[model samples]
Target: DASGVEAVALALVINSGVTLVKTIPLRRFEDAVRFGIGLSPVFTVFQVDDQITSSPHIAGPTGDTRLMPDPSQTVGLVASPGWALAPVDQLDQDGEPYPGCPRTFARRMLERLAGHGLELRGCYEIEFFLGHRAAPGPDEADPTPAHTGPAYGAIALADVEPFATALIRAFEEQGTGVMQFHPEYSTGQLELSVPHSVGIAAADTDLVVRHTIRAVARNHGYAVSFAPVVFAERVGNGNHLHLSLWNRNGRNLFQGGRGPEGMTREAEAFTAGVLAALPALTAITAPSVPSYQRLQPHRWSGPWACWGRENREAALRFVTGMVGSRPDAANLEVKSMDPAANPYLALGAIVAAGIDGLERELSLPDPVQDDPASIPARKRRSLGIRQLPASLTEAIAELEKSPMLREAMGDVLFDSFLATRRAERDVFEGQDPEDVVRAHRWRY
Candidate 1:
């Protein structure tokens, strides 16, 4: 649904661009015509590579080639003679401002953070499912093993050795650091952690890693999904975003051994901002109907708006490694996000919200030592702890009310996204659960 919304938004922008920009030179058409008559329509997609390539047919029977950007060029061919001449790297479809372009939008938020003389860095740990590419029957059980080994077992290599080996190679080639891959609790589910990097590279590595996993898996006749739920009974997958902030002089902002919760004032404020914005950010972080199923309490998915040390049950987890561990290992792990989220949007929103907190000097609540899920209703209310969006419709409603997000993502793209998502919700909200799973479970 998010993908379709993106597509529709891009199409609208491209159409606007094509209308405003002058037509291609007549000579270019002549050149394309020379390729052959009855050939699929042809158009020159001026690419960053400084080359022009023509396709006889823009897309074959399958829409794969049509949606794929040219290998040598960054432009995607969406329709015959219609190409995405401008790379939507961080821009919108219309060559105008697009707040929805996660890359561009994240950079904007990062710049805002910089205005306060602070810097941010991030790392993403992705959990996913891998198994036979074939679809399973309704009553059929998935034959794939729960994992290659016990939880975090290095010895369970046999189950995912082939897949892991290829994943490692692809990550290396893509210039991404592969920290590790281990069997997770879910059947055939695996988690891969990447060495964290500063600023944009951290997000870039994540996007590349997702591409690498899918490509490597496809080559091996396996399908990999980053979906939150691949099966009802199994643990769902999640995309946990780990982040830390620092000052212009490179001081770790989240650390102040003598300060509140060992967090510096600035770090505390930033964390407060993110916590306050958590509900609204869910539209971009989780953003799917099925994602809510994974955010249930007691499932270890952070649903409550609170933070704690080494607490997996809290939305904002303050990870403290061993006594001898590097202090930088102390960072916030947001466990509410899922693979369905566009990394750019999620990162941007997190950064923006955190910046908001710092600018406003927001105060954070005391850490929840016991189970946040089991906290008394009165205590939870007193502390202002709230739950994340429980469904796509609710998530979108939250998103629609976010003035911060609307400002970060341009008015046009945001408006388009809202419209498209509302249309989709109208179509899919009340459908059969099994059919809903079948229709969208693997799409992301």
Candidate 2:
């Protein structure tokens, strides 16, 4: 029992579950987990070419056309401990947390949670698509759809056997801790489920998984996209996050029994806080333009901010089993997030909001009884359930106005993210949904 507590606490530092091998030595694990040195802001340099002439009498003549160099200084990489590459030096010899890394954002959020004497536990259910990068033709049927034995579908798995085997092996090597890989409802859709971990470690595992999946798939000449709306008019990918909260003493604070939704006072407060901050959180969860394409009604996407027991239609789903059990299973699945969204920043925003609710004693709202989309628009509106941000523009606006989100991400990261997101949104402003997906599908 105490092992579980130690595991949970240690897991806050590393991404995957700790496993020991018969052949592996204990000393090897000393450097097995790569916990970086520290978090400090980095600097950036810009090269410029334009030159101006100065008066000889006032100041020394700056050679306008001679060998003069012009340089500009800009804010360097935003530092977060969980980042994979160092933030400032994109080309540094040693690996550092990559810029725009979501894991770093989540680490920052965990730091914030520490300030309030709290801890977090999280897990991710990620969905994606697997396809041949260089097929015979765009119109030709993929010959390698199921090139191996059919684990699920006799015909499909056999066609794509090689791809499946290679991907699984690669994932294992990368320490992704992949629980299962299965064919989804769509033709090429695949889902990867991973074991849960506590605090920033869980979020970091997510980052490693996402990057490894895409990179390994590419090495096999296959392209993958976690875009929620990857296939036009077909089932899209979703990055549903399972979240829970704990006190500093290692007690799960979310387990409750008497509430209308089977949530405790603290749980209710956390949920209420998430609901209160969701309008802004969407910008991080569904950052891309195509994200809104899946957030529409009647698509099993969680457009409405309604929570209920086993209700997939609601944005927040209350997952329960029976009586007062483990709070680990008594968490909420935020279904609004997509694969393209940065997991770190998105999770951080949500955790910050939930912690805010606990601090302020916010009251939870009534859970929806029926399908929110079918409850009639006016009725749904009356219940205080509104559709999430329909586009990146609206989502950004909501984020800009949320003081909680701004404070959680800090000024450097918040500003850099907004700037980068604005640029991304602008480039895809008029592109078709499918075009947008095609251009950015596997880049993440």
Candidate 3:
């Protein structure tokens, strides 16, 4: 207790993009880690509304799983003194890897990639709106921006600088690199980017960074929403993923090679793989009902099925980097993703899709020069461009049909994931868009 560590939080990022937690006092931390903290299997299907939904393989209160903390990544919460947090690995009753754990699924996929002498350096861009409750939304509590400054203006930065400084310091203290932190285009929206790491570590850092942001925001008396859509009419938050495929020796595979824009043959194949899976990947990257509100055409949300160099409207925006940066700076960004996605599942599924492409020696199609939506329908069709799933129902339906994803996530996990998505789809069958936006504005 010398560090005022009275309690420790054991966090499990679940399938529904919720961080389910169990806490233990510092005195029992050893016990908890040694014997795991107990929890129910029902959390696998929890909805944004906190209602319990069921999958055929997992339902009722008949089963139990344990959460084992990975102590190496445990971090002290600077904003909330007297506490620390650990991301957990879920374990079955018999102490086997829990089949439903997204982290485990991600680990298996990363391992698969590693076996092929390829790896991913990835980071999730975190974006959220800072506001206070102004009035009731169409069906839930509505919030107004805390700052009056114009979007991305110096005034906006000045208004939030004190808070931003504290956040940057907190991130540094927590061992998270702060690449850049700034006010974004949306009212009261702010974003933070961290340096990339190995795929699994990148996903872990995402959970840590998000937890830290929420804690720091509370200390500053501000509300934060990581939801995909906080308002029906306004531009919404989309947290993109920046990733690069690399060899084990740390050489960037996307630079200094024969393929278009300096991409190696393998790099081109991997990029093509991700592009091909855009339709199926949206189910994991933009999974929620409100996600559809933000995934529309002309919003720079990458609602189309294509890739481009520096094209924000392309689902996969390939960053070839500036002249001097060369090999190291090259990367690809998945733009259709948002805060509603579970970090582990999204990273894992994307890597799995890329791996599939690499194995098949897939070829990249022509990168769109302009917005795919701006392209005429006939032109889009001629260029092999198509809109990605426009709704969660379509996304999940696409997800259901992906044998690659099904195989990547074992049969049990795949079925449970689809079951949860379908269950949420039914809950939101006819809800108004604004209502959907309000419901998830703070759910994450």
Clash counts per candidate, in order, are 3, 20, 0
Ranking by TM-score: 3, 1, 2
Q: Which one wins on TM-score?
A: 3
> What is the C-alpha lDDT profile of model 2 across 102-183, one tens digit per residue?
4455666677777877677878888777776544333433323222323346566656567667667765643455678777
TM value for model 1: 0.76
Write one digit per residue (lDDT tens) for candidate 3, span 1-444.
228778898987777788777889988888888889889988887777788877768888878899998787677877778888888888987889988889889989999889889888989988888877655555545787866558778899998887898899998876777999888877888889999987688888888888888888888888888999887877778889999988977799999888987899989998899988889999999989888888988888888889989999888999988998867889999999999899999988998998999999999987788988777899899999999998999998889889999999887778878877887888885798876776777788
Candidate 1: residue 267 lDDT (0-100): 85
Taking the tens digit of each residue's C-alpha lDDT, what string does model 1 give over 361-387? 998888887777688889888877777
Stretches off by above 4 angstroms in model 2 are 1-105, 135-176, 215-221, 322-327
TM-score of each: 0.76, 0.71, 0.96
